[model samples]
Target chain A: MKNMTMGLAALALLAVSGVAQGADDDHRLDDAWKAAVEDNEGVLSPAQVSGLNILAYESAVARLCDGIKLDEKKFAASVAAVVTGGSALSEEEQVQRLTAVMFQLGTANGLFLAEGAMKKDTFCAHAAEEKADKDNPHNWQ
Target chain B: MKFSRTGLACMLSFGLLALPPLHSPSHAGKTADAIAAGLVGAAIVAAASRHHKHHKRMYYDSYEPYPDNGYDTYWNNVYSPAAGITCYRAQVACYKANGHFSAKWTRMQFADGE
Candidate 1:
């Protein structure tokens, strides 16, 4: 009986450790994305850099939520789509993109992008899947 | 699609306005400076008016994002290609509305002439 109890505790510890390790793995994805942005040679104003950082961070979150299993094939396909479809925003799209990211993130959580925000439908139906920054990769943010 | 005559004209006028002024032969007199200022001012008003008129025609406030039916180097340099994204998944709204329009316009921005 004593040994069984010890085994259970050990299992719990392992599970908790797994969760922490998983979240840390997600951070690696975020860091890689940040590095990519920094690697980008495109000239940007301070404001633009800030905006891009927010977007990239949020986007990385979204991608993580979308799936952490990204390998070579998915990465290539996703890049092709964005490269092919992205608005290539004009000077104005910068503001709009930030706003959109906020809205999408806000709506995904039951509450807006503020405190007390939950995965409820008051904001949007797709909120359940958009957990971009919520430590959950399956969310809609 | 090609830039319409109106779009071309608008781009040219604004393009010139965006360019830096030519070096003055000499900055000796107030009159010379005023003349130069007037040229720039006229350019501003024309460009501003055109900007207003052009935007007024479309609902830019709710304007959707571009769809990438094709590719463009400039955009790639700016917004690097996505990881697994095949079509531009810009706005949830725009993509939900007309996925096709987004793609065509995207390619045009790249293929469209200067």
Candidate 2:
């Protein structure tokens, strides 16, 4: 009986370790994303970064709740316009700035999706409520 | 011993499966940057306006419009692309909501650009 109990305790330890490792992996990935953004910190202001992050999160929520679709060609044109509009920066600087902005946007979106996955019922409920709001752009009805 | 090993393997597999795919950095070429920039920029523009409107209702707050300087020349560039990014974001949300969490599915969403 003692041997059996030891085995069960061992199994529980292994399970807890597995969960810890998973969480560690998540933190590492998040750190890497932050580092990538920091690499181009010279390009975007803190406000711009904060604004972009919020924009990314809401966009993810809106997309999920609303049934809207993306148009690639038009999006490309718009980005080009924004990039070119900053004529003060050299081409290389412009590229770096754009890359940094994208990293911020992608990171926020991915984090939101992960949050939704982990808290699906609550997240979906909130999303649905947001969608139902008549003034929300996510509201197609 | 064998049963314990099997349980450990299963737990590890589950943990791996539960993780969302990491974002891969693409090489920043002019064309690719433009496309990627447009994709994210458009999304930002769309989400910014939408969020502004939403906030307005909740807090009666006003958002700053893009500056009226020369930057205004390209502000209009965002409209159509904003729609595209909004659609892409929606597609991603749909994928996640439906529980399609595979890395391949996530990559395909990015590749297909919708």
Best lDDT among the predictions, by candidate number:
2
Q: In candidate 2, what are the lDDT values of residues A59-109, reduced to their tens digit?
A: 455456444332333333322322223345454344434455555566666
Q: What's every prediction's RMSD, in angstroms?
A: 20.5, 21.4
Q: What does the lDDT come to for candidate 2?
A: 0.38
Worst 10 residues of 2 chain B by lDDT: B78-87
* Each model's DockQ score: 0.02, 0.02
Instruction: Estimate, for each residue in A85-110, the C-alpha lDDT of model 1 and write its tens digit.
Output: 11454423332222232222223221
In the predicted model 2, the residue pairs found to clash are A63-B90, A69-B87, A70-B84, A70-B87, A71-B84, A75-B81
Residue A45 of model 1 has an lDDT of 23
List the candidates' TM-scores in order: 0.18, 0.34
Alpha-carbon deviation at B27 in model 1, angstroms: 29
Off by over 4 Å in 2: A1-42, A62-85, A132-141, B1-114
